[model samples]
Target: MARIRIAVTGTDGQVARSLVERSAMTACDVICIGRPMLDLSRPTTIESALASIAADVVVSAAAYTDVNKAETEGALADLVNGRAPGLLAAHAYARGIPLIQLSTDYVFDGSKSTPYTEDDPIAPINAYGRSKAAGERAVAAAHPHHVILRTSWIYSPFNRNFVRTMLALARKQDEVRVVADQIGNPTAAADIADGILEVARNLIEGRNEERAGIFHMAAAGTTSWAEFASAIFSASAERGGPTARVAPIASAEYQTPARRPANSRLDCARLSRVHGVSLLHWHSSLGPCVGRILEQGT
Candidate 1:
């Protein structure tokens, strides 16, 4: 049997990088492309990038992910986050390849008392969320074999994510005030990439096309932003890293250009049941990430 060919966009982003690495390690032919070479700013580049890739599956990890900045840069965000995936969907659909696009949990307004389901009504509270929501709609309308995964509180060992930021701050400051009110699970980027590959395997192996849709792919439990910070600092401490006290504060205490969903918790039940993929608990996934960062001397 021939090996599967997987093409992943946004090759430089943490999520995309992890997926590419995993794909390579698993013996899959992975074509990972990034900006300038595969510029998402130019909408036509999406199709052009995938044209000669000879891929059986396409994972779109590219996006304008600067959330706070998106408030002032709405048009650019729309171009990259909204329109690009739609174009990719068109190309993937034409090639009969499954398109797996990463999304965010910001699509919800945070009013839901529990984690959000796939069918939950989308009401983005900020420009970033709006752009992502638009991207989801575009992919859904343009392609039949597509999976839009909405993940939140994403942190990885390699990226400029919350974990990294907390560790840096803990070293520099005596105390860091983190938002205690905002709640969501901290998803490991590696776990998310693995989950995506699992889904892609099913899709490429003659699995049902009906499996395509929006799915929440976060870890199993939920915690507030403050609690999450504590977890990061605790892990860092255990790893002989910084261990500054993380002070709890309300979201209002920290001001930014855009508003954040108070509760970014996503209901991943549909993802687990439909794909039959179980992700590790948030804490369980933390140590290895920390270990990797330490090994790399980050």
Candidate 2:
């Protein structure tokens, strides 16, 4: 049996790297591409990059992820996050392969008190959210075999995510202020990588044909930024890493150019029911992630 070649974008990003790391245990040949080879901002280079790799599957994980900066760089964000995934999906569709694209929960306005389902109407309140929402629409329009997995508050043992940022701040300061009002699940990159691979495996094995569409894939539970920070500190303290007191503050107190959804929780029932995939609880996933981060001392 030949190994399934998986071409992934954003070689340097957390989720992409996690996929590469986990590929060792699977029969998938994960090839990660970034920058000059597969620049999202340079759409013309995408087709050639895909042709050069000739992968059995493509995972579109690269994006302009700077939420606050997206406000000032709307055009670039749109180019990278909005238009690029669609073009990549089109290329994969032409090759008769599936394209798994990573999306975000920011597509919602955060007004709903409960978890947002796959059927929820998108109404992004920020530039970053708008860009991601556009990408989702474009990919759906361009490819029939596309999986847009909407996740939130992604962190990992690698990369500059909230966990690392909090640890760094904890080492430098006595107390770190975090927003208590903005709530969402803090999903681990490794869990997301596993979810992506599960979907890819199903597609490869000619299973779950009806599950080719959008779904919510996230951690099992939700928490505010402040509580998440506290959890990180608690975990770090237990592991003898940098720990600090988290001062909870309202969202308005810590203003940003981009308006984050007050509630970014997502319902993963469709993913579990359709794909038979579900992630660990946020706290359960965070402990190991923080331990790895501390072990690396990055």
Candidate 3:
């Protein structure tokens, strides 16, 4: 009879925007709330802001996402990434609905040689990672019906992600230098949104009670940042859009305030095995997104 209602936090972020767009194909409503209505930056306002919302599940897709900036703005990052999620979980617990908290792969220290599993130990090496790790704890503590998804290298046609950045740079520069040492899945926001919706569907329908914990939900394949950039340009070139040569470089050459993991690739087998949801390969998902970005000329 009635379609399910999936309430998501944040409005403009890549994941949030993609979730709204992706929901059109499903028989559920994705209601996105952010800013003045759900000021995650100010954790004190989230309770009052989200008081009137009604939904089958709550998705905490909002957070302090500036990794490099987070080094100096640790307190602000903690407030938005840590305390805000706990408050969201508290609301979800109060409402008796499932809470889907969007987490990051940066939670791991990236020292492990293989792709990380859900059970792997969390040892965040940066302020942003620590803040997200804190949020995971807070969410787990506050809500029993919660799914913490750890994904990586998110890109989309809708936002200021790596995909868009690469395309924009190709217009001005002939060659772009990207790190080749750091490895992870180059996940599409739309793919992530689809996976999230499926998880929400399972949670709302009460199909799998056991799928109530952390899960890695990245796209299937893995590659270095430089390789990912090459894929972007290859697809862009095929579409007659902007294309550039990706100059592979070491992580040390392009140092930033945040020290990212050497290997952040997530093992998404748990999500596939438990919820039966597997996202498309990173390159497969990138083609259409590149097409869309070319069409819009953004």
Q: Each candidate's TM vs. the true structure?
A: 0.96, 0.98, 0.98
Candidate 1 C-alpha lDDT tens digits along 13-98: 88888887777677477678787778878876777788868898889888899999999999999999998889989988998888
Q: How would you encode candidate 2's per-residue C-alpha lDDT over 84-108 as one tens digit per residue? A: 9999999899988888999999999
**Runs in model 3 lying further than 4 Å from the true structure:** none
Q: Candidates' lDDT values, in order?
A: 0.86, 0.92, 0.91
**Regions of candidate 1 where Cα sits further than 4 Å from its true position:** 296-298
Residue pairs in clash, model 3: none
After superposition on all C-alphas, the RMSD of every candidate to the true structure, in Å, is 1.3, 1.1, 1.1
* Maximum-lDDT candidate: 2
What 10-residue stretch in candidate 3 is worst by lDDT? 43-52
Backbone atom clashes (below 3 Å) for every candidate: 0, 0, 0
